[model samples]
Target chain A: MGFKRKRNDKEGDDDAGEEVREVSHTVKKSHVLPSSIKNKDQRSAVYAKIKQEKKRDKIKKTRARDAAEKKALELGEELPPKKVPRTIENTRELDETVCKPDDEELFAGHDADEFSSIIKRDSIPKILITTCRFNSTRGPAFISELLSVIPNAHYFKRGTYDLKKIVEYANNKDFTSIVVVHTNRREPDALVIIALPEGPTAHFKLSKLVLRKDIKGHGNPTGHTPELILNNFTTRLGNRVGRMIHSLFPQNPNFKGRRVVTFHNQRDFIFFRHHRYIFEQKETKQSDTKGKKVKEAKDEKSTFKGKTIARLQECGPRFTLKLRSLQHGTFDTKGGEYEWVHKAEMDTSRRRFFL
Target chain B: MPRSSTVECGGCPPFRALSFDVLGLIKVIEARGGQQGNTPKIVERWGEPDASRCIVAVSINDRQNNPLVAVGRKNGEIELLSATNGDRRAAVIAEGGAIASMHLFKKEQSELSSRSCTLLTCTINGKAMLRSIEITNSSSDSNSTDDPSTTWNVCSAGTILCSSVDGNEKYALFGGKGVELNMWDLEKRDKNWSAKSPPKNNLDIFTPTWFTSAAFLDKDDHRKVVVGTNSHQVRLYDISAQRRPVISVDFRESPIKAVIGDLDGNTIYFGTGSGDLASVDMRTGKILGCFVGKCSGSIRSIVRHPEFPVIASCGLDGYLRVWDLKSRDLLSAVFLKQQLTNVVLDTNFSGEEPTSAAANSSPNDANAVMENQDEEDTLGPVKRKKSSKDNKQSKKHRKSKKKLEEEDDD
Candidate 1:
């Protein structure tokens, strides 16, 4: 034997007590650092060698796994189960208030809720968009974009009139809802959506707003009603908020416009996006890879030709909204009862999600 | 704060009928676990799917050993339903203008144990009428049950915002927008005393006298009243002293929608539009604290159990929450599925109520009597025995649990 080693150092290795390689006639070098090594330079060199060996071992293990997978596929065996990574959403706490799909009570309640009339198409939603009392330069531009995004929406000037008076006027006008843009330092930072007449108002703290001119390769929105897509609004409170937003749009969507608006709520942060989608046939490598999985599953090595897939192009005015509070009725700054209030104390746990 | 893991309603007063006014229905939950343990089962469901008859106000009179609940609909109709079963015992068309409030009580001169009950209902436009229900025959069938008569109007002020009866039912307090707090003598049908609006604030802004909810502070005295305003202030009015509030406390920024008095007169429980259920010390004018369970909508009704340390709250959130008064913790909560307009607990909810607590000195005596009633319930002994063994612990739950288990053990 070329060398001798302590049995405990390489205890976990399967080939530990095997005979030394006949060609080399030598034992493997253990990557353990000796405590007696006093010199800093020698310790640094040993550490570097150990790190390199560990990297090589990891790469070798992955290579072996790949080889085994390839062999298994060639032998027509089942593929190994994929490893699932743990995420905050996957391990979120159980929310008791989550509305089940078939909850008749919740469904029956929705049929008689505040937004029911508008949502049921019994009355069309006529939105009166207005800015706060204070003037801001970009506020007009944002309001204009909002007008384009929502069907049957009109802009009202932010004069000296109070919100309660405005709401009363809107009620007389039979406007279905009111959207007030709150600006701070010349930027629209908040959006208040108040259902008209007998009201339930939602105040949203807006962030990361990108207007039509700001987004690159953004398309212009048309007058046709865009389809609404609400995602991840599962909780009871979320259901109410989702309905409030849902009633803002017209019932029948003009699919010909090819425009779509999405309110995606993930971890309670609503992401608003407007896009124009087109379904076209494209014979590219990307589509070929998708077909490969199908062909591989059937054990038929056939090539896929032209495939039609839907593609989306951004239609501007993208933003994120976090609900600050949802008030029961109209816009009474003083005494309106809030349906849901976002307090700092609610976020005590990282994995707890309301929506 | 940790949520209470167990429902503390096991040792509750015999009045275990917890009925919540859902959209068009009144759903009753058996809180005493008569048939179900731990889980409070829905014993009876009242009301139909008729949209025209939406419920607005509910008053349950289970106090005088009567299982009758008075339900006021939006069409200004009051229907008396059997609390035990969901049958229509009687229905009367009270002044039609959309019912604002309703109360079921016996006449002040009538005996406490009298079976004859009076119904008081008011409309939004301030038209109130009373219909006394007197059973024509003692063994009356469902078809011919009640003969209602003595209908009279007690209209005081128009656009009535809030109205409440004190413990003695001698005076009724009424307040509304632009209307000052007015106390009406129910017996004499005359105005006794009216509140004077407070002076303007430092900014010369007049706090609108829009009382969203009001309650008599003491069950025994009709002088002390707690009024919640649309302006989000809780005013404590001592009518014996001044016409204005003795102490006005602001709770958050939401309008107080429900006002109620606790066992002690000083502690008042209130629920704001923002779903904050908190107690305030009337003497010191300081907020005690908000209850642990968060409500998701404006609270419409908050009723404390007459003889127990528990309160039930319901509102637009459609959830009826029963909270322990001593610990200020949510003991049991149930989702009624409709935007709840009101919630009422049967003071003598179950068979647990002592048939004769005439010589009763403490609540413990009532609990001891409850043990004799629920002895046959096999499940009762298991729960009560566990509680009795853990009596050494100072936990309110254990005390309540021990109380639920009678000293006259099976």
Candidate 2:
């Protein structure tokens, strides 16, 4: 009895456990491997054809693979598997770094070619303007001019004829910094700088001395020689301005260094600055080098002795923020203290800061 | 190393930002049960009044309501118990046909002591019976007027698989020979609305089974009936729209049970065949982010507290887990060593404090105390059993301590 067997892999398949016909199941003896090989040349030809087909298929697959890889490399992306679509959850996470300020990135908007003057806080940002008379309009004009230059600067409204009121406010009310403006004809024509211990308070006294006596009536030094007076005035103003520039910005807790320019007249200017404290360096020789030049210069432009820029050298006992360099003469006749930050410090952007 | 120096120069804070923990899982207790394939015999293992059986559905009634916990078992037996003392007050209230589902009504105290509540039980044998029990305290001296048990023939069809009772005593029936959702208004004692699922693919050959869990959502403005099907989907149908479900959510797992409650049934908590308990926002049709974990067994039943937005659920896995609906977080869990076919919580228990704000504040904060006091007041005098005098004293002390702590934070 001949029967056929059935595959029962899926549902609704009724045929199973059946016997197969002997004629269909029996192997054809003439088609066996040995018998097929008896016709050697024909069999060899068939084998060659199969081998050629295999090689062609392999080469095609390799070419396709190479082409796909080359395209992926050119596009800066790897080919994803030919499957499901991607979702937002598959993207890379975001960087969480916060940005901060950098010294080289200060005045980001300005040109960088010019040599920038770096400023540090020597003391609170303060300045005083003294003239010949209280109502000479020079003192008021100067006060207004300084206010116009830095809108945040404080003016005490003290008398040039009398320095007591200015001194009392500076000492008692805890002002950030003090400036004393006195006429050139008064005694003690000297610019003084007094440093306070802890609190933001400094005492200053500016006294002007008579240079030449009047030879005419009343014998009062009214019409003094302009040369001597101008020389003395410029000298004293230069020293006082230098000292004031060395003060700190009162409100800044992180004050490090500063660049200061003091203008007295059209011909003379005083430049004093404080640099960031380098705690480990031996600073004795540096401070002496700057001080000696200032003393020797007197009124004339002290010869640049190549003794390094007259920097306000730091003494380590304190967080000695001192002058880094000094260049005195007249500034570009800008007629005002041009306040601008250094280009290098201003160029840093938030993106570059993180990088 | 030098890069670190550059970072130091930039003056960045030496610490990381803050983070908060969302899920507060205090404890986890496992119950006894094994994963097994679906079979009629396996399903029958739960219907007995054995504590080892899974507690499928749970509910805690308000103090004034004094609701009872009616647990429907896999074997089609229901056990009514008192939630307050964990006492099995009624051993076998009803038995016989394979129980597809059951629910106990929210009742007033007068109704509670008098058993003036309706309990709806559905069977796989195409029978839906509404049993009204006039509960009488055996310890009480008062004479009971009404009969203790009364049975009403609600509906008869193929398996009367799922049934839901609304606040108005309306019964919504889901399973039968057809995919049609049928509602029987218990108030009117008649079938009001019905909807049928369209035939599709392989499912088209037979009418879709009735929803195992169904409820009326947003009962205030728009009355929407939400039904959970055996096919693992949650469908919402506006009663105003000829009973056709308006939204169907593929919840990914079969929602074996569902309930609507809390401020117009805006929140819906349901369980899955995979022992997963989840909630849905009916208004938005969005799944509230539920803290993920498995109950000891497949959640066979679920019920919401009558007053508070809390849910009590039980599973074939034998564990009973309580959930906070709004937060969708597991609040507490109790292990029932045996498969919990049905579970219920009595709402008579005190409410838990709203912890989000107070969670960060010191316990003694005066504002927290005042806020809690305000909540107590809102709960009404009948809810808080403590005398007013004691509450006032405790309030004062708490306020003072909180004030002191606030000063410290400042």
DockQ of each: 0.33, 0.00
Give every collision pair in model 1. Answer: A337-B273, B14-B349, B14-B350, B15-B348, B15-B349, B16-B349, B16-B350
TM-score of chain B of each: 0.78, 0.59
TM-score of 2: 0.36
Candidate number of the best TM-score: 1
Residue B60 in candidate 1, Cα distance off native in Å: 1.6
Q: Which consecutive 10 residues in model 1 chain B have the weakest lDDT in total?
A: B352-361
Error of 2 at B122 (Å): 3.3
* Number of the top lDDT candidate: 1
Error of 1 at B57 (Å): 1.2
Expressed as tens digits, the lDDT of each residue in A93-141 for candidate 2 is 2212111233221222111101111123333444443333433433344
Q: First chain TM-score in every candidate?
A: 0.81, 0.23
Instruction: Report the C-alpha lDDT of model 1 over B255-350, residue by residue, as the tens digit.
Output: 899999987888999998878889999999998888966556789889988766878888876677778788888766676666777777766543
In terms of DockQ, the best-performing candidate is 1
Alpha carbon lDDT at A61, candidate 2: 75
In candidate 2, which residue ranges exceed 4 Å CA deviation? A1-355, B1-67, B71-80, B86-96, B107-118, B134-136, B139-156, B171-179, B199-207, B219-222, B253-264, B294-296, B305-312, B323-327, B351-410
DockQ for model 2 equals 0.00
